[model samples]
Target: MRSAPRSMSEEVIPLVEESAVVGKREVVTGRVRVRTVTDTIEELAQADVQHETVEVTRVPVGRVVETAPEIRTEGDVTIVPVLEEVLVVEKRLVLKQELHIRRRVEQEAVEVPITLRKQRAIVERTDPEDPAPEGPPT
Candidate 1:
């Protein structure tokens, strides 16, 4: 015959949504409050980088080489076009351009609700409230 002491009041819920980049993310953490964000956006940029030049040629081939230079006299003919005279090289490239004008400042972080009014004294209830744990969620 004991049933009269049920009065609990605690309500605090604020959870924002919308967060992209699923599989991988380097870094992301946000909370902001700057007078509800006014209006100011300025950005200046310039980029034109170009430098590339190339011209290369090389050929060398002559094997089964048996030489006896006396104008090849007696036995063994003469057909010399050994092939070795083709070379041209030129390559130059440079790139360095930097321009800047960036002024951006934004800040906001405000989430406050802390109430631990008091209720923590049940050293051991001997485990008997588990209709699939109908507990801990207020």
Candidate 2:
């Protein structure tokens, strides 16, 4: 079977507007006034030959649509570090330091022989010692 172009109908239908989008099979059946040709035999032709009709149909063209993946810029992501604060408090010590009064009750120097004067003694002590013990004692 051979297909005929529908646009060829445009060549015959000069009355249709040029910019009109043709729709699906629109049929218009209207009556047209016509004068009959008559001769000697008068009782012949029918009065109303009203079967004139037109059908309009339209075909849509194919279209294409595309969806792509969403893209994000590097600036969209952000990183932040958490920070904490520390506070220091100072303490004052209230101490009463009692200096020792070395009562210089020098045991009357038993007139020691100059030979024994060069003697030395060793002693063990504990408390972290304070400096400069002075003055006459009780």
| Candidate 1 accuracy as lDDT | 0.35
Highest lDDT against the true fold, candidate: 1
Candidate 2 residues lying further than 4 Å off, grouped into runs, are 1-90, 107-138
TM-score for every candidate vs. truth?
A: 0.15, 0.12
Q: Tens digits of per-residue lDDT for model 1 on 1-138?
A: 999886887788988988887596554243222222233344333344444433222323333223322322222223223222323263222112111222334444444444333334333222233232344422
Could you say which candidate leads in TM-score? 1
Each prediction's whole-model lDDT (CA)? 0.35, 0.31
After superposing candidate 1 on the true structure, give the runs of residues whose Cα lies further than 4 Å from its correct spot.
1-89, 96-103, 119-138
TM-score of 2: 0.12
Clashing pairs in 2: 25-56, 25-57
* Residue 37 C-alpha lDDT in model 2: 34
